[model samples]
Target: MAAPTPVRRGAARHSELFDALVELLLTEGFAHLTLDDVAARLRCSKRTLYTLAGSKEQLVRAAVVRFFARATERVEAAVAACATPADRVAAYLRAVAAELAPASARFVDDMAAFPPAAEVYARNTAAAARRVGELIGEGVAAGDFRDVPVSFAAEMVTATMVAIQQRRIAGATGLADAEAYEALATLLLHGLARDPATPARPSAGCRS
Candidate 1:
């Protein structure tokens, strides 16, 4: 068998380190985390950690990005596995909840408090909206959903999720992010459902 390429080997190493960092980040917020602290926990040298990122902030950002990227991949796969568009949307939201279940309150708070991490989260949420919009478009094409403007509906969902994440809605309504996402999926799916008694609306192409 051929030896693994340097890039592949590096990715494997980084994956291990990222896993450890994620666990620690869940328990401790990014604001109080340091390279040395992570190095000590992972039993790796500071130099080893520096190989992945130039600084602590960069490291945290990289970890957050990598973690969410992996989670999104999982969600997309689950969504694709569903036969119907409604099932796909539900699968995506459920996959997201499963991915986020391990995150503690401290981790969520840290993502909001840290600017770099917050930016990573913002990008992830935007990507999710685009994906959801595509799913809605597919549903319309399949005659499984109402002829709602996909872009408008997707933006609404994204905006609502952001509000929940930032604690704006959560603070006012006492709803957790997970609960908000569940409610979002329920509301969106219900609103888009094609009535058996009524005729389907005309298709409006809704691309992300």
Candidate 2:
């Protein structure tokens, strides 16, 4: 991907501010957080914050989009490091879990409260679902998984992801998002498991 537009004068300071803002969002959630709160936390003025974006909502939106962009990079890297399709699938989910592990219940609720942030998160979810579909296709082609219909399986996993994000299953089962993702990896792969007696081949369509 191309580089993102510069947000501030110094790259280092910009990164620091983004990280601090993310921490605040994760701790306090977006609903109750204010421009003043961000300024106070960063030891800066509201004017200084404004230099980054036009308004409070815009600032948060930019930060959230940046955060998810970085997360996607990390997840892609993690998946690429694996040798097999099964491993790639596991790596992808595990990387996602790690990225989301810091998010608390309040943080997720806050994202729902903010439309811009919610939209960014929803886009991330859609991308993840597509990636999962690709991995499943690779596994099946490599004889590592069953011959499940790619579209149907992908939608099923995507629907489950949406449920997980909405906290529907998590609220009822008391599972954190990260835990839910791990469980999903296990459940999907186990259900599609191929016999160990057969030799597995690398998928030509999948690169790691």
Candidate 3:
């Protein structure tokens, strides 16, 4: 049999690299990140680093995206595990808070110092808002939520989350990720709740 083609040596998923990236981002902050630090932390060669992730910028962006995705997945699972709509919403917030550990807190601070990464982050935030708007709409249809402007509501929640992140870094008047999620959910739900005094409104113009 012909020998199998040589496996090209390049970056694998490299969980270690991602973990290291996150750890350093927290300890050193973003602007101060250097490949040498990651290599030192991982005790890997600089050559291995290059093969694993291209540049500091690439690594930071990838690590942030991957971290958030993993966090979201776990939070989604938490939300699914709840039996009541109220429970599910509360659990979702907690899950989100738990995901924003101290390390993740530092990533945003660092991202702000770099314009290119910052722009990527801003775009990502908008995408996240659109995706979450869909979930809020689902709640409304189930009668668990009142009709609210879906897009606007989602943007408000996302903006609030950003503020929470900033607060976490500031170490003053901090809201744990879970706490922020719960408070926001409650605030939104209470405002949008249907009642004798408040008729059910339709989010007719809201986008899918």
TM-score of each: 0.85, 0.87, 0.69
* Model 2 Cα lDDT, one tens digit per residue, 1-208: 8665564336667677887887777777777778998899889888878877889899889888877898899999988878888888888888899988888888887787788988889889989999999999987887778778878889999999898877787888999888999899889878777766766565443354
RMSD of 3: 6.5
lDDT of 3 by residue, 97-197 (tens): 56655555456566666676666556655554555566677776677666667677777877876665445524554654446655776776566566756
Query: Among all windows of ten consecutive residues in candidate 1, which has the lowest summed lDDT?
Result: 199-208
The parts of candidate 1 lying over 4 Å away from their true place are 1-11, 196-208
Per-residue lDDT tens digits for candidate 1, residues 1-208, read 9999999998999889888887788667677777787899889999999988999989999889878988989888887677778888878876777777777777888899888898888888778777888888898877788878888888888888678667677677876666767778888888888887887555332222
**Which residue segments of model 3 deviate by more than 4 Å?**
1-13, 149-152, 162-182, 193-208
Per model, state how many residue pairs clash: 0, 0, 2
The TM-score measured for candidate 1 stands at: 0.85
